[model samples]
Target: TLENIHELALGIELAGVRFLWALRKPAGTGNDEELLPAGFEERTRLRGLVCTGWVPQVTALAHGATGAFLTHCGWGSTIESFAFGLPLVMLPFIIDTPMIARAMAKRGIGVEVARDESDGSFDRDGVAVAVRRVMVEDEGKVFATNAKKLKDLVVDEGRQEQYIHELEDHLRRNKDV
Candidate 1:
C-alpha cells in the first residue's frame, strides 16, 4: 500500500485535479516523512494540499471546495464520504475493503482503481484514470447524485432518535444484568 502512495501522488498531479491528501509515514522507513513522489508537493502546490498527519477529515470534507474522496475503502471512510455527499474513488487495499468497494461501485457512488488480480498491483495511470473519472469527467455526476442520496439516508428525519430509542429500550430491559 505504501508503494501506491507515490503513484497515487503522481497520479493526482498528473490528473491536475485539486486534492487534499492526508498522508501517513510509510512502514519500515526511518525517514520522518512519507516517501512521496519527488517534488510532488511543489508540482501540485497550486491545486493540492498534502498533510503528513492528523488531518481533520470531517472539516475538509465539509468545506465548499471539497469534491470527491479518494479512499482505501475503509468502512468509516466510506461512510464519511457519503455523509458529505462526496463520490468515492475506491482504492481498496485488503479484507472487507474489496467487498465494500464492490458494493459502492454497484450502488453507483464509487469508481474503483484497477489492480492486478494476484499481486494487487496498480499503476499510476490507473490511479489517474480513476481520479479523473470521479473528479474531472462527466460521468462523475451519477456518482455524486447517488452519494448525495446516501447523505440523505444518513441524516434523514427521525433516524437518530429512532436508533436512540431502540438502544434505550434495550438498555432498560437489560439493566438488571
Candidate 2:
C-alpha cells in the first residue's frame, strides 16, 4: 500500500469500521522506514499493522472484512487487488504506477491521487486526500460496489472450473506457439 495507509488507519475511526494494514517484510531491502512518514510510527497497534515474514502477501487480501486496498499501482498488486475485490486508493510512485492507476481508474476499481506536475513525490496531504476519497467519498463507495461485482464474476464456482479448463486448453494449444 501507499501513503493512504495513514488515512485508512484514521478514516475507519470516523465511520466505525475496522481497518487493518498488512505490511510485508523486506525481501531484499531491509525495513525501509524512510518510505513511511515519521508520525506514522505511532500507529503500530491502532491500525493493526502487521509486519511479518511468514504469511503470503495475498493472505491479507483474501481475508474477509478487507474492504479496500491502498496500493502502489504495481501490476501484480493491481491484479491481486482485483482478485480480492478490494477497491483501491491508487498511488503511483515509480515506474508504471501511473499507468496502472489510470487503468484501474478506468475500471472503476480505484482512484488515483494527482501527481506532482514536476517531481511526482506525494506529500502527506496528497496521500490523505486520496485515501479519504476512496475510504469516505461517494465515488469510492461506487467503486467498491463495482469491484465486488467484478469479484463475484471472477470467483463464481461454476465459472472457476470453466476458466481452469479454458486455461488448460489454451496452454495445450499454445504449447509450441
> Against the true structure, whose TM-score is highest?
1
Candidate 2 global TM-score = 0.67
- Candidate 2 achieves a global lDDT of 0.69
Highest lDDT among the candidates is held by which one?
Answer: 1
Count of backbone clashes, every candidate in sequence: 0, 0
lDDT per residue (tens digit) for residues 54-156 in model 2:
5455887898867788777888988787788889887776798888889888988877766677976555556567677777778788898888888888778
lDDT of each: 0.87, 0.69
Instruction: List where candidate 2 sits over 4 angstroms from the true fold.
Output: 1-19, 22-39, 48-55, 157-177
lDDT of 1 by residue, 78-170 (tens): 888877999999998879999999999999997999888898888889989998999889899888999999999887769978998999999
Look at candidate 2 and give me any clashing residue pairs.
Answer: none
**How high is each candidate's TM-score?**
0.88, 0.67
Distance from true position, residue 89, model 1, in Å? 0.5
